[model samples]
Target: MTTTSVNQDKPLPGKPGVAPTFRWAILTLSLSMLLPALSTSIVNVALPSMAEGFSASFQQVQWIVLAYLLAISILIVGVGRLGDIAGRRRLLLAGIAVFTAATFLSGVAPTLWLLIAARAAQGLGAASMMALSMAFVAETVPPSRIGRAMGLLGTMSAVGTALGPSLGGVLIAGFGWRAIFFVTAPLGLLTFVLARRYLPADGPTQKVGRLGFDYVGMLLLALTLGAYLLAVTLEHGVFGTLSLALLLAAVVGLGLFVLVERRATSPLVRLANFRVPVLSAGLAMSAVVSTVMMTTLVVGPFHLSRALGVQTALIGLVMSAGPVVAALTGVPAGRMVDRLGAQRVVFVGLIGMVVGSISMSLVPVSFGIAGYVTSLVVITASYALFQTANNTTVMTGIRADQRGVISGMLNLSRNLGLLTGASVMGAVFAFASGATDITTAASADVATGTRWAFAVAAALITVALGVAVGSRNRSSSDRHD
Candidate 1:
């Protein structure tokens, strides 16, 4: 198979010489991806323990997760662009090193504030990994094997995400909450060593016109997202006035970011790309998919453990089924995308998700274990299909020069979706429970909240389906033209 150079001016870093070790390189890089992905969910099970240990409020405990997500969402696109310019391998290695150090700090954090700070640092590292890992796979693997490689990567990511909670629960149950961070330290170190030894060095230097970092635009974008996230965090609190103010600030900041990007020499997001219906719809669908799936992930365990009196480990096992199916289905989904085009595959997947959400919503509080597992399997399969197809659509629609930027935006869309979904689900759960403590009314509140959340998510998926249909028709028209 011939390997085409995406950038002919510079020799590709991982050429045929590097091909022999390609599999190992992919494996090591995947470990870097897995660590961050796992950390996102693993910490959730430990939140209660963390709160008690530090005498922190629920809001404070939430920041531990939110801070990391917000950082990743805002910075991923910018950093991914940098990786394309500077070298993916360099950024990936640096990210791993920083993430490893942050994990250690989090493990020994004396206060909740420190842990939150560590998490934010960790997120920056995660952004680097998430942005470059795909680009590396695209660059290193031959076209004939790209689909399979992507499928495997997607599967690993799914498994990592699904395993986090159960693994964390077991670790916390046996050792302590700190073990959650400690456990990944060695893995991170090993990955770093392998990356340094096997990963090729290649940073392409292209003379991009008026190339300069858009510092002001980046700051505004960060502030905008930060304010919006802060407002969401204050949803059920006495700080409504502050929340409103922050939300307003976020809107203003976002407007300024758009204006700045329009005039800036080097913008973080390429505004012109959205002109393509496929790109626009694909991103929108990706966001909706994240919101829906994350809501299920966040609320499912709470409902299972509190409402049904299931243990955390057992809940994790049940929840794992969805991602497990998703992991297994990703390759087939990618293959289908290759053969059938992303639009049809994504539409079908969205429909499946709608079906899954409806099924989950209808599940009774007393649903048997088998029924619960069935619901999870359907949800997972739907998500896997949707995600793989959506990724193919967005990535393949753009020019090679823009892949890093678009990929970063894609990651941002996903992280933002998860952040928004978790917040919305939390608010719904809080509202449903009234003023009662979560522990006392765990079952009823969780079940009611989860049902409502799933229903809302289903409604969102319906909107995404409409968008997908429109995109498909538009693509057909373009082809005819």
Candidate 2:
């Protein structure tokens, strides 16, 4: 690459001796992250209310969440590529606009399907926002300041998570389910205005060609992701014929996507990103950690509601503990990453996850709420540690040019993990409890399922631990050699 090409990837330097643009830029990007992070947690409590409002089945109501995940996972890479070709600032502004509009649509959606569609659009917008924010922040801030900025972003995520369930409960109780969506509308608008006012404007983008983007590869990639998610959503312990067909379609679509990428002059995702040891290993660990974290997150409330006959209000209260602890831990974890390096910090985090998961798996029916809540705190704290360290590792390892798509890949691993956790844990729970309908099953059965699910979570976390340790050892060996 020429000097010009390399320089284009770097952030525009703040004017010397004037107001610090880096601080303002980090603030803008952090606020951008807050919206999507808030949205993810806030919507869960309102699902029941939404189901009641729309007179939808439990299974149908799940699409509200699944659709959002599917949309984000499928389009993130394509959108990130667009941001690379276009400008990150411009794409971020567009994302805010779309997200704000979609939030309004979600608030006013009359039918279940309409709400699902709106959520999907919202997810697309959220994807764009998330995919670029880290890259934008990292590029804008100086290398020395990167750790502090990442810590701040981690704090913002924790704040969003900490606030979500509590705020959702209040909104749902006071106004109705729609209020949950309505509250975020103004947040989106505020983010948009602040980002526009504060973010640095993009310079001229270098033109590639008449067909700058690999449209064929983009389409195939979308199909591949969409088909795989659909197959998971339709799974019935064992895959049904429809699920099997979808899975096969996903496999074929992936093959086609690879072929198209090889032929394309400008591909959506570069195969070379995976060659970076830290990037690849960090992403892999992220997926596994997310799988473990999300499995417990999904199953914990179920266990509480069923086994202990805990009320929804109490469950929400109990659920807030993890995020609150995570929020508190975020900055400290980032500092640790800065001091101890990502490998060592991530290793400790994975150990926490393993311990938490093992404790959860062993929780007896007689175990009180305190035990569950303690387990939650441990797992979430571990998440804070792992996420901050691993994210820093991935971002720092890649080139400035690769940051956009690497950000997308990071988020994609997470969403994929969430989907995997939900599906795998659900299937395991069902099989262990011998219940066809896991949701409305007997309390004893549900408790049994929760135990089995946490065992799986523990196993996943152990794998993450191995990955962390192996990477650390490899790096040390290389250094020694």
Candidate 3:
């Protein structure tokens, strides 16, 4: 298969055979993707150490993770819209600066609350980075190489996820839990510099107030999202009275947000944009597919230990297989998208996920760790393909002015799916095991739960597949007519 660099479509004015500008720009964007993804998983491994150092409970320590998620979930789309209005490159630099400073602050914080506050700050930076990086790809990379650029971003993200746990383990063992936060500071600094030098400046035409900034709409949307996220995550994804109240709040907030947006001169999200068949389908598929992937992470450890009797020390190692596959598959999958076309590749990827999900649900315990890994690799690798194609299609299809918000929306869907998966899928696993707590389930029951959860996962993927198919048909019919 043929591949091209970012400048192939339209060469930079300055250099010949030395696409230094393009290379540096790609590197900057790549680091932007990596930092946020790394932060998402890196802090997880340090939770125990943090609790011990802070003299805190599991619930409190968990806030270290949730605080970050809450900030990102609530503000990612807002920041994305803000980027479009303010300037993506400018905000991205500010974001990196915040993230880098917060990283060091987290390491040095004397109190647990201070550390959590730092993390929330880091999440603000992460929200900017993740929301703008994909949008920037359209700005920097040539249209022909968009797939590869998307793939590279995906690969960086996967690498960050795969690297976080093991790297955190080493850092904790060698230097303590604080080292995990400190280690990425220099990387952030380097990313900031490269971005400042390499990325194109926002054009004069892109200034704020063509429609005016939609403050009311943005705030209402953020509150709505925050409420929904809290509702799903409170009580570990189970719904209770408070959860019900939060859900109701989310519903009311959403209604108000829509009303506000309709009246605003400019809105954070264009409610009418959902009418585009591909965009709507892409968001729905992204959410559901992400939920299915979360099943593997949520249940893999319990299934490995309780069902297969794998040692505790090796559980993380075994669980790393999916990300390992994802890291390896990202670039190649992007190439496939460039060659095969995004829609076809998306359909194929969904089909692959369906097969893998079924295999995950049915692989007998007798077949052991290898069987589980094989099925997981299948699903994970297919996800790499689907994600690359889906992102490429969405990012490339939209108007240039709207890329930032759309990019944020994409990230928001992914994050919401992950949060939902942790709660909903975790509950499904426990229910299938007939155990109040999954950790205490018997070996056979754990195995049974693993199978049942993946069966549900398979159904979720099947639905995503249907969405892709139905959307494609509608899009085609609309075009032909």
Candidate achieving the largest TM-score: 3
CA displacement after TM-score superposition, residue 24 of candidate 2 (Å): 3.1
Q: Which of the predicted structures, 1 or 2, would earn the higher lDDT when compared with the native?
A: 2
lDDT of 2 by residue, 1-481 (tens): 0111222334455333334345556667887788888887788878898888888888899889878878889999888778877877889999999999999999998889999999999999999998998878676765555555677787787798778877998999999989989999998998898777667776577653554788888889999999888887777436789888999999999888878877778888887666556777888998888878767667878888988789976887787788788888877887788778876778888889889888988977787798888888889898888898888888885666667888888889988887877776767877877787766889999888888888888888888777777777776776798
Worst 10 residues of 2 by lDDT: 1-10
Among all candidates shown, the one with the greatest lDDT: 3
Candidate order by TM-score, highest to lowest?
Answer: 3, 2, 1
lDDT of 1 by residue, 1-481 (tens): 0112222233336444443366566677567667778988899889999999999898889889988887788788877887766667777888889989998999999999999999999999888888777767666665545555555667778878878888998999999999999998888899888887767776556543336766787788888988887776666433478888997999999899889989977777778878788889988988888888877777776777777788755776777777779877877776776677666778788998898888888888777567667777877787887787777667663665567778888888887777677677666665665636666664676777777777887899999999998988897899899
Better of 2 and 3 by lDDT: 3
Collision pairs in model 1: 307-443
TM-score of each: 0.87, 0.90, 0.96
Tens digit of lDDT per residue, candidate 3, span 244-278? 99999999999999888877778788989899988
Query: Judged by lDDT against the true structure, how good is candidate 3?
Result: 0.88
User: Judged by TM-score relative to the true structure, which candidate is superior, 1 or 2?
Assistant: 2
